[model samples]
Target chain A: MATASKAAADSRANLPFVYRQYSAEQLREVLHKMYLIRRFEEGAEESYMRGLIHGTMHLSIGQEASAMGICMPLAEDDQITSTHRGHGHCIAKGAEVKRMFAEFFGKTTGYCKGRGGSMHIADVAKGNLGANGIVGGGIPIAVGAALSSKMMKTGKVVVSFFGDGANNEGAFHEALNMAAVWKLPVIFVCENNGYGMSTSTARSTAVKNIADRAAAYSMPGVIVNGNIFSEVAEASHKAVERARNGEGPTLIESKTYRHRGHSKSDRNRYRTKEEIEDWMSNRDPITLFESELREFGFIDDRGIEAIREAVAKEIADGIEFAKASPSPDVSETGNYVYTEQA
Target chain B: MDAMVRELSYAQAIQEAMAIAMDMDERVFLMGEDIGVYGGAFQVTGDLVDRYGADRVLDTPISELGGAGVAVGAAVTGMRPIFEFQFSDFATLAMEQIVNQAAKMRFMLGGEVSVPVVMRFPAGSGTGAAAQHSQSLEAWLGHVPGLKVIQPATPYDAKGMLLAAVADPDPVMIFEHKLLYKAKGPVPEGYYTVPIGKADIRREGRDLTIVATSIMVQKALDAAATLEAEGIDVEVVDLRTIRPMDKQTVIDSVKKTSRLMCVYEAVKTLGIGAEVSAMIAESEAFDYLDAPIVRLGGAETPIPYNPELEKATVPQVPDIIAAARDLVKGVR
Candidate 1:
């Protein structure tokens, strides 16, 4: 019995951080969520093509693992401030895809009750402050939320997710400096998807890696292959633990790529088709994570097929729920501008 | 409403209100550039750091946009942050967070969040601090829908309105004039609130109604005293809150007074006076106007560094008296 226990402990030590930390059931659930994020975006894309949704959307087709891995270590009460390309983050943070679809459909049952359609969608109850439309806008807000946590002794660590583009913004520098100076519990996650709109980070940013800028703010600068679930989750786990321990913030630059353009309006003039196809076929986060799950015996072929089928059903049901939901009254346009007086 | 009143300067009144608010709620705190041991640019947050400690009385770095956004974020979560822009002109640097985020967060989030933040701005000219340091930009923020903008004139209103702003669930902008810091008035001790969006009739008369705001309220009252000997019978209406402006009070005063003259220290064109003039024109008071409406406001120029030039920029007591005399005596 002593020999068997020793062997089990050695086996766990050889496994990845996520495998060591989470149960097999939780790992399977993570895969299910990754599939949910991918399918949800694809569903939203199809809906947009059918002219059901207005306005452009920023899709995160190839960054599923990054979103799931970052959120895996966070509790339901642990807050996150996302960017415009934030559907994956919202889903990974436990937002129901049905309500997200309802918001896109401009229905009252939506998370924002049709007020914040896509860019501003939030699940406050789930601790998603909201996805900001402004680049680097949520950075300071995350610091402020961290300040609230430290001041109120709530022990809630906040994660601010931005793109490579936000690295050049003054708000990014200011927020990082303030967070570091105050030793606030927050994580600055920059998903370096190569570009901010059409501009590449090499052309826009002064630093080679966004994480390098974190040094000026006096915090740990971590770089990870965002396409690899284990790599991203391992980095996130350490950063989150450091934050909870009140050691201050860490900057994690999750190096990844977007399978799609910056937005629906993106003409795809900047990058080559060969590069896009390469990432799609070789470096797709969902494919990589799924293969890892299978190799580790966490999910088999049958299990993967069932998860895909379930996700497909959830997407279909979500679209139907959105279609059947009611739109807000035009007369109530002035509502929510100020708190309703009791 | 209580008889426990004492003479206090506008700055002291504001300081006392901050202490009272901190005592009442643990979430209430102050954030600014020099609000700690430096005591603030205008010495408004004097030594509160000693009592509340640096944790609550935070001295933020000179990052206006980021600091303002932080306050908004804290407010939305649970903390009641009172962010002070060292100078009102610095508000230009932080307009994105104040206008786009704090003012629109609640509406954009579909009421899922309310930014209960209070931002204090020491506004108006006369400090000889040049164009950048001195500006009456209350009208700029007052234009926003979700924000409640107030300009308290006296010590009593400063303390009361500040406490009211702290209690308000929405974002409240207090535009305290720089010149009024030394101005003294009777202030009641302890916690009290002066309801926002309500105007105070400083002095009542029958001939001409002077609608004033901030420092202009006191100037108008002084002009009323001077005109009393001249038999002008001027009524001074301190239009305290700018956004959900006390339109009823202005219209009623106009209906009784038969003449209206808007007095504000902001630029004469498109300032608070324009809104007051337009409101009266659209109201029932339009028929009661015995003479053309006059606007006594700041000159159409940036506040210069010279003391005399700065005085010339905004309306003075003599300017109010002249404007009032002309309106009451049937002269444009």
Candidate 2:
């Protein structure tokens, strides 16, 4: 017990003062969320290839830290609005993985009751507001949520997650300006994953750093190493702390990369294989966390194997649950069209 | 024996209705650009900020999208927000928030939440505001699902329809004609909620059924009276709510009148009139029609800054009268 306590304290002390140390069980929960997102995306890709899933699927393959890092600092009641690439954020915010899978499968057991596909899953019970398909759409919504929190005196914060493409949208500027003026409790996380669909951010945006835009709004802007889980976690923790302390919103530009194409159909015409291989081999967040834990003597090879096996089993169980869930009734298509109760 | 109540302008009726609703429900609040201190662009929200504090009657910045988004979020979280657009033309700026977010959230969320927000815009022409500030875009919103569109033409209907919009569980877009704000009529003094998705018969006759909306409703009634002098009895119908429209009322009126004419301030092509004409043609009343469904709407050209050109753009009283006369006489 003393050894485990000392290891946990050391891990906590190593992190920035903004982060709260987790017990072994809490650490397992965070790991479970990350693994669920990874497994869910893998399954979705397989299903898409097999023609079981229609429309586009924006996989959060190599950008798990951007989700888990930001979510770890939020309270259960804090709200979050996500972008089209949103499965990781939803999983991190405590949405049921099985239900999310069912949603992708268009089953009635889905979070949106099969009405919303992968890009628009919402679980209001879990404070996961919803995912938006439009670029920069969720920014204003998150600010509105923060306004609601302040008006209702809930002491809750809202996190708006979007890609680099959203930074150019007009709503992004308007939302940030309003949030700053009102000093709303919100966090704007820009997952600058190199590319927005086929276009690279370098060619699209004139500014090298998206975080620098926050200076115009008078908000604290920070850049984090999105591939390094600990660094990403440290940045998010500080931002969330500032929000919770009523110090207004923070803008975090997480520098990361996506292993997969923007959607299922792209053929990697833009980037070189060497670049992809370098990030996959050197900056993989899961592998880095595992190696750090092992070096700290927190777990041995057997324990690591056990963790992998548990994650695999959990994912397998979620897939089975999703497969068994029934599809939504076609006659009920117009059921939720309006809430007028007939 | 009933006593005659005092007559009030359409703007006055709307103000009275909002005041009554605000006094009754604490959750109800008014918000818009220039609504507070400025008393609204049309002075419809006159002295509201003074009567109610700034908190309840908010003056937003020039950000229409932000104001609309805030209203939507607030509506979903249990507040009844009555958001005003300075003019219906400015509503285009907030279309993304209104059409995408507020209109679809309930359906997307599996009916878990309701957006009880009322967006009031001063629509239609005759104000000489021109182009950007003068346009009728209710048909655009009515095309979208999960939204209730209302156009109140009379003082009584304005008060009753506004109350109904405020009490509605879904988002309602109330399009008030800029020309009819000063039009005066007798209105009862009290809280009354008229049912939406229903049409009111302004004049009943057997010659023809003239379906109109917003400013055209008054024009249609005027045409009906003129046609009545010529022994051409015409029935006029006011389509208060465009979406969830009163198809039954229009069909019944058309069946009885055996002739139909749809009038609107929108363009002649693909306007609300086109939809109503199609509905009448498709319904069982098709066989009972005495003449083809005639639609009198605005010309397909931009509303020019010149007052004469602007008048030519939309259906005026004379155009409605001429259309009614021609349809009744079986002349195109």
Candidate 3:
């Protein structure tokens, strides 16, 4: 008798179905997060090229929207396991840009206290399990975390992020089977950028869509256009809800592209420059999202300009924060080897 | 609440320690291959499944990499997980998780989180599991900085050390000797912890310090008993916790005895005995030593299935007796 339904009733921003009914403000926040990731990566690359950032880094310049869309549905307590090209994932998962930059600069105030550098960045309080250096390394860990949730009856889910190359690893099959059998609450998100380093997915992976392999494990398999912000959100929403309701795991393959070479060492010899340009010009996640926002009258030119300036300032502040932070003391290097403090 | 002390087998001791840990902490759970229903490969986890239920005593698929990774992940989050490898040799499959993820997460994450995970490995050469199954690879894990490698020799140490390992805030690798599972000793009931990174002197002597590991501790003590008739008092130090290598205990014993003999079941090259020998050489014990440091380790080859070859490969009671007799009689 009482119609207290408030699913989409608490919104004022006139945004359409691209985000499954996310209001204009929520859409703007998504765009903001994506911009932060994009600029953070550019800042990192610039520092690396200038010899300010130590060690090599893998940049996810083009795969920004996939990070935002997938993590958008997750709650604050939800967890994610990221890959080597993890800067975008970290930012989209809500990690502070300053600490991330500090980590890359090898400062004591960094995420890993200057020990992990780029590949092993983590924020535990934010429920990020940690980014892995090994391919397919975090799949089982995600499954395990999901198992802990199920065992404790906590009703929390975990999203595991990996590249296309990791699907070829033995851990992929093993982890999927275990998660399937137990019906653990985990989402295996594959960002298939068509390449695992230099080799294309065509050469390494025999399957057409990485999600199709999910059928073997008796789970839902869906593929989405990774560049489109709303499509990624729509695709992952069903899986996240199903996992939360205790259905099982889902394998969602978001088809995206990387604008830059795999790592700083990549020569871009695997794919042509023209092909890279084609993907960049047409399928850029930020550009398409901005165009969609204009079409829907959710945001205007001034809004777009203000958001860009703010992101640029935030990234510059992160760089300055990293540059000013000091290196860890040599004597303190041995302190964290064990949890025991004597 | 039972305070009465009773004899428990090495496997029983380890099982009791795990049971005590799980009962004490709700966050603790066990995961491994066929461990829940099949009672594990060696039956060390025989009755844990029935007692803890499937949720806590989980039976995992035959995927060491996945199981190990899951354990590391769970530990990194909040749970205290005890993962069992059917054979220590299978740890090769889990090298990435154990060495890379579990061991390094804390240091790599700047100590924001600690991997309170325990890995139980049924190791050593006595069972004739051969090269694929029965290799004593303690040295390989000990070489790593973040791992705490412990080879529990007796029933008491097995239970106490396992409880201690589960309580530890870091990854502890428990190398439970396959041969010592059935070996029995007096162990007290209820909660207790044998502090890790410390060695226990099983027997005290004045003539020589025979630093031994795992089952070799019992062998060294037996050898010492036989040498007692020959008027040779041998101090047998059970190097239970291998990674930390309690230098003070070994050094102090060597200083008192003025002679040392290092013995273990692993390969002589880069074995636990090498660390003991090097410790004496580096410490003030070197000046007090009456003779060159002697080490009795496994032969540099795969453990043979042949009974005689297996016995020949690892130092047994008789071998320790011979080594002790010779070392005490000024034999190089």
Name the regions of candidate 1 deviating beyond 4 angstroms: A1-9, B1-3
TM-score of 2: 0.95
Better of 1 and 2 by lDDT: 1
* Top candidate by lDDT: 1
Which pairs of residues collide in candidate 2? Answer: none
TM-score of chain A, cand. 3: 0.95
The whole-model lDDT of each prediction reads 0.92, 0.85, 0.89
Badly placed stretches (over 4 Å) of model 2 are A1-20, B1-6
Total clashes for model 1: 0
Model number with the top DockQ: 1
Judge candidate 1 against the unseen true structure and give its global Cα lDDT, from 0 to 1: 0.92
What TM-scores do the predictions have?
Answer: 0.98, 0.95, 0.97
- Rank order by DockQ, top first? 1, 3, 2
Candidate 1 interface RMS: 0.7
RMSD for each model, in Å, please?
2.2, 2.7, 2.4
lDDT by residue (A244-291, candidate 3, tens digit) is: 999999999999999999888888999998999999998899999999
